[model samples]
Target: MSKTITNIHTIDLVSDFKEITKMRLAVSVVFSSVAGYFLGAEIIDFVEVLLLAVGGYMMVGASNAFNQVIEKDLDALMNRTKNRPIPSGRMSVNKALLIGSTLGALGLIILYYINPITSMFGAISIFLYVSVYTPLKTKTPLSVFVGAFPGAIPFMLGWVAATGSFSIEAGTLFMIQFFWQFPHFWALGWWLYDDYKRGGFFMLPTGKRDKGTAVQIILYTIWTIAVSLIPVFGVTGRLYLTPVSGVLILILGLGMLYYAYKLYQSRDEISAKKLMFASVSYITLLQIIYVLDKYIRIWI
Candidate 1:
C-alpha cells in the first residue's frame, strides 16, 4: 500500500503539469501573440517569440493553478471540475501554490528579457486573473467584465512585446478579443448553468438560465463580429485585412453568430455547447486568417 501510494504521488505530479491547463492556454495565447506580431511588424524576432511562448505559458499556468486552488471546494461540487487536481485531492493546495509561484517568477523573468512593457503586461494579467477574476467568479456576473481585461491581453500583448510599445495596432488586437469573451463565456455559462449553480457561481444576468441571457449572448456575438471586421477597411496600418482575408473573416464571424443565434433560439445545453465550440473555432480561425494575411502580403 505504501509503494502504491508513492507511485500514485509520482503520477499526480506529472498530471499536475497537465491539470494546470497551461498547454491549452499557452497554445491559444502564443498563436494570438504571433498573429499580433505578424500584424504589427515587418520583421519577426525568434527570441521574442520564444520569450512570448515561455512567458505566456508561465503567467497563464500560474493563474490557472491559483484558480484551481481558490475554487477547490467549489470545483468538487461541479461535475466538470470535480476531477481537477486540488479538488480531487490528487494534488495539495500547497503544491499548487509552490508550482504557481515558481512558474510565475520564471515567466516574469523571461518576459523582462523580451521588454519591460511585455513583462509588466504579463504581471498585470496574473494579477487580474488570480486576484480579481477568480474571487469574483461566485460574487457577480460582473466578474466577466473584470476578467475580460486579462483575457484580452494576449491578443495585444504579443504586439507590445514585439514592438516594445502600444499603438492603434495593439489596441485593435485587444478590441477584437475583448468583444469576443462575452459570448464565449456566456455560452459556457449557459451550458454549465446547473453545475455552476452547485458551485455558487452567478455567471449571467438575472442569475438564471433564460431568454435574457440568450439575448445578451446574441448581442455580444454581433458586437464581436463588428469588431472583427474593423481592420478590413485598412484602419490599423499593416494590420489591414486583404480582400481574401476580409471575406474569410466575415464568413467565419457570421458562422459563429449563426451558432450564437441557434443557441439563443433553442436555449438548450446541447446547442449552447455547439455555440461554445463554434466560438472557439471562430477565434482560432480568425487568428489564423489574420496571420495568413500578414504572410501573404509579405509574399505579394
Candidate 2:
C-alpha cells in the first residue's frame, strides 16, 4: 500500500511538472529551433540537434514556469488559466521558482556547449518572457510587441546553434517568425478577449474587440506574407527558395489572409478562432516547407 501511494505521488508530481512548464507549447517552440538548425546545418549533426531540442524545450519551459509564477494571481482570475499548476494550488511559488531557475540554468549551460551565441539568445528569451512580457500583459497592449522579440528568437536560435553565426540568413528567419506572431497572437487575443479582460490584460491592439483590432491583424498578416517571400528574392544570403516553393508559400499565406479577412468582416469569436487555427497551420506548414525546400534544392 505504501509503495502504491509513493507511485501515485510520483505520478502527480510529473503531471504537475508538465502543467507548470506547459510542455506542449514548449515542444512546439523546440520544433521551431530544430527546424532552424536544419536550415543552417552544412552537415547535419543529429546529436547536436538532439541537444538543441532538449535545451530549447528547457529554456522555453523555464520561461513558461516563471510566467505562471508571476501571473498566478491573474491566472486564477481567468477560467482559461485558473487550473494551471500555480493558480490551481497544485504547486507553490517557491517550488516553481526553484524549478524555473534550475531549468533555465541547465538549458543555457547545454546551449553554451553548442555555441555562446545560441546560449546568449536562450538567456535573452527567458529574461524577456519572464521579466518583460509577463508583467507587461496587464499594463499595455504593447506587451505583444515586446513579447514578439523573444518569441521570434527560436528560429534564429536554431540557425545560430548550427552555424554559430548571426547573419542575414538568421535575420530573415527571425523576421518571418516575428511578423507571423502578430496575427497568430492577435487571433488568440480575440478568442480569449473576455477571459483576458477578466485578468486585466489588454492584449488586443485596440484593447477591445473592434475594427481597429481587426485592421491591425489584417495589416500584420499582409506583412507576414510579404516577409515570408523575401527569401525567394535572394535578399537572405544562404537562403533561397525555388519559384515552386514561393508559389506554395504565397498560397499558404493567402489562405491565412483569407481567414484574417473573414475575421475583419465579422469581428466575431468564430472568425477569430478560424484565424487562430489558420495561423497555427500556416506557421507549421511554412516551417516544414522551408526545411523540405533546403534538402530539395540539394538533391535536385
Give TM per candidate. 0.95, 0.98
Return the top candidate by TM-score.
2
In model 2, how large is the Cα lDDT of residue 216? 98
Worst 10 residues of 1 by lDDT: 33-42
lDDT of 1 by residue, 165-234 (tens): 9888899889999999999988888889999999999888667778898889889888988888888888
Per-residue lDDT of model 2, residues 142-249, tens digit only: 999999999999999999999998999999999999999999999999998899999999889889899999999999999999999999988788988877899999
Cα lDDT of all candidates, in order? 0.86, 0.94
Those runs of model 1 whose alpha carbons end farther than 4 Å from true positions after fitting are 1-11
The residue-level lDDT of candidate 1 at 207 comes to 78
Residue pairs with colliding backbones in model 2 are: none
